[model samples]
Target: MNQQYEEKLLNLIDRMVETASDDELFAGGYLRGHISLSAANCEMCGKTSVDAMNNAVENSLKETQSELNPADQLIVNAMWEKLRQEAYNK
Candidate 1:
């Protein structure tokens, strides 16, 4: 289940490469790392739920929140939410 969710998240990001604006592209790329890492962590910890994966990603983002400026942070946050919703709906 975690792997499926991770793939959905990654597919959403991958689909953005062709038409995403510069900011969206940047946000997607930035989020890919967090999502991938969180998924791996979930796997290592034997966590299979999508919620666990999402929480791990959220925590990872908070941990590195200082890396982005306020505007960039907003962009990434918005993109993350969008991706999460889209992935969940699929």
Candidate 2:
């Protein structure tokens, strides 16, 4: 995994968490951990930034319950979907 890409992903997620609404507890916590783990796990995986971030987000989402608000879910899902498509295209 590319260090710069990992940092990019973390920056995006950090921004997301910072701007999350009060009810987005799951999202904030999940993003925080995902950023940390992504930076750690993909430090040398040889994957592109998109792949690493998508994998990190999906993996984190999988581990937690999905009790999310529709709006929050919509935002997070959209972000992930866009990144997923970008990763596949790369």
Candidate 3:
């Protein structure tokens, strides 16, 4: 990944960790790792990591959506939106 993309992904993970609810612990952590690894892998492949990470995270969220309680799912969705927006906010 480019430095800028790596920074943005890390920054997004930080923001998520800061604001995520207690119930989001495992999911958020997994999301962070997913994005980080994807970014690092992209650097080796000479690709844009942001888009790849975004799609992976989005797909992961969709699969995990059923795991959250209804109310928690809403919160997760909102947090995901915020993180997504912040990731590209530079």
- Model 2 agreement with the true structure over 22-89: per-residue lDDT tens digits: 64545545455665676566665655565566677677765652756667776666565654454354
TM-score of each: 0.98, 0.48, 0.58
The runs of at least 3 residues in candidate 1 whose Cα sits more than 4 Å from the true structure, single-residue gaps closed, are none
Candidate 2: misplaced stretches above 4 Å? 13-20, 24-26, 66-90
Clashing pairs in 3: 1-43
lDDT of each: 0.96, 0.58, 0.65
Best by lDDT: 1
The best candidate in terms of TM-score: 1
> What is candidate 1's lDDT per residue for 4-30, written digit by digit as tens?
999999999999899999999999999
lDDT against true structure, model 3? 0.65
**What TM-score does structure 2 among the candidates reach?**
0.48
Counting only residues 3 or more apart in sequence or on different chains, how many pairs clash (N, Cα, C under 3 Å) in candidate 3?
Answer: 1
Clashing pairs in model 2? 1-46
Per-residue error (Å), model 2, residue 6? 3.1
Q: List, in order, the clash count of every candidate structure.
A: 0, 1, 1
Give residue 61's error in model 1 in angstroms.
0.3
lDDT rank, highest first? Answer: 1, 3, 2
